[model samples]
Target: MILLFQQPELPKDQPATETQQYGFELSDFLSENIWYLLIFVLVTALVIFDYYRRKKEKNNGN
Candidate 1:
């Protein structure tokens, strides 16, 4: 089991740098772009709602 998920060992003589330690942190990214994420979600929801509303109206008319 351990061998199934073994990772490459880093050199003990040199400590891992900050860039190597934490690359592309999603929590930090989301916090920084929370506004954009919210806007995207809102827009996507609105578009999906509008599509279903229009489809329901068409079905009712037919």
Candidate 2:
């Protein structure tokens, strides 16, 4: 399993610089707006379900 976890070797002449070696970390976009998106999706799903339920009931009653 060591081969699976092995670190790739850089070129012999091309040494990795500090800035190149360690780039800036990326922020988690989903984690930031997770709650807002979750609420939005939940509300949308509920609205769609309610719409379909009402439509079905109306059709059945007719």
Candidate 3:
């Protein structure tokens, strides 16, 4: 498995740069934006679920 913070080597044909030399993984992204993205997803899911639930309730005349 690849490590999140592992710094990958520069491409053989390309010159080494500070940014490109270091590759990021999915865990790194989530760790950095966990609070923001996680909350956004959770809130979005709740809103969508609630919308469908309310629609069903209305259709059922409740």
Candidate 4:
């Protein structure tokens, strides 16, 4: 079991290679999902809110 967990040693003669860095940014997230998708989601949320608000108001009035 210990042998299965052991990592093979890398040769020291090979030169190190540069790795590309990944970073998160607001613009990247917006572009990937599409900005209009986010806006429509917000509008849908507002509509749902107004629906519940009206329903509560009608119940209280009766």
Candidate 5:
């Protein structure tokens, strides 16, 4: 178990590389999921707004 938990040391001269670039890509992600697919469960306000808008339109329509 100790052997599994222990990590091998790396050279002190170089920094460790990151797998991903951090921070959100708001525009592309928001457009792809929300605007196109309308995955409403992710956002509470959007779900509520969509429900109200649909209800209002259904009631108001001839």
Candidate 6:
């Protein structure tokens, strides 16, 4: 039908607002546990570096 093909009218009411609540607060958490955070980062970096080094040595057959 022609009526079915016609575009619908926009609503008179305004769109609803949204509230964002959840997110990471890294600054706060890091400041509270600076030493632990530093140790964690250092250990993670060392592990990643060792992994790549071992992979390179293996690929070179040495």
User: Which has the greatest TM-score?
Assistant: 1
Among residues 3 or more apart in sequence or in different chains, the pairs in candidate 3 whose N, CA or C atoms overlap within 3 Å are: none
Write candidate 6's Cα lDDT for 1-62 as tens digits. 89998879866876544322334466767788999989999999999999999999999995
Q: What 10-residue stretch in candidate 2 is worst by lDDT?
A: 20-29
The TM-score measured for candidate 3 stands at 0.54
Error of 6 at 40 (Å): 0.3
For residues 11-59, could you state the per-residue lDDT of candidate 4 as single tens digits?
6776544332345667677789887888999999999999999999999
Pick the lDDT winner. 1
lDDT of each: 0.91, 0.83, 0.86, 0.82, 0.70, 0.82
Candidate 1: worst 10 consecutive residues by lDDT? 10-19
Alpha carbon lDDT of residue 45, candidate 3? 100
TM-score of each: 0.67, 0.55, 0.54, 0.47, 0.32, 0.53
Per-candidate Cα RMSD to the true structure, in Å, reads 10.3, 11.3, 12.2, 8.0, 7.3, 12.0
Worst 10 residues of 3 by lDDT: 10-19
| CA lDDT for candidate 4 | 0.82
Q: Report how far off residue 14 is in candidate 5 (Å).
A: 40
Candidate 2: lDDT over CA atoms? 0.83
Which tens-of-lDDT digit does each residue in 3-61 have in candidate 5?
99776996577653443344446665787677555545657778889999999999999
- For candidate 6, report its TM-score: 0.53
Global CA lDDT computed for model 5: 0.70
Runs of candidate 1 exceeding 4 Å displacement: 1-14, 17-22
The reply for model 2, stretches above 4 Å from the true place, is 1-27
Candidate with the larger TM-score of 5 and 6: 6
Candidate 2 or 4, higher TM-score?
A: 2
Residue 29 of model 2 has an lDDT of: 56
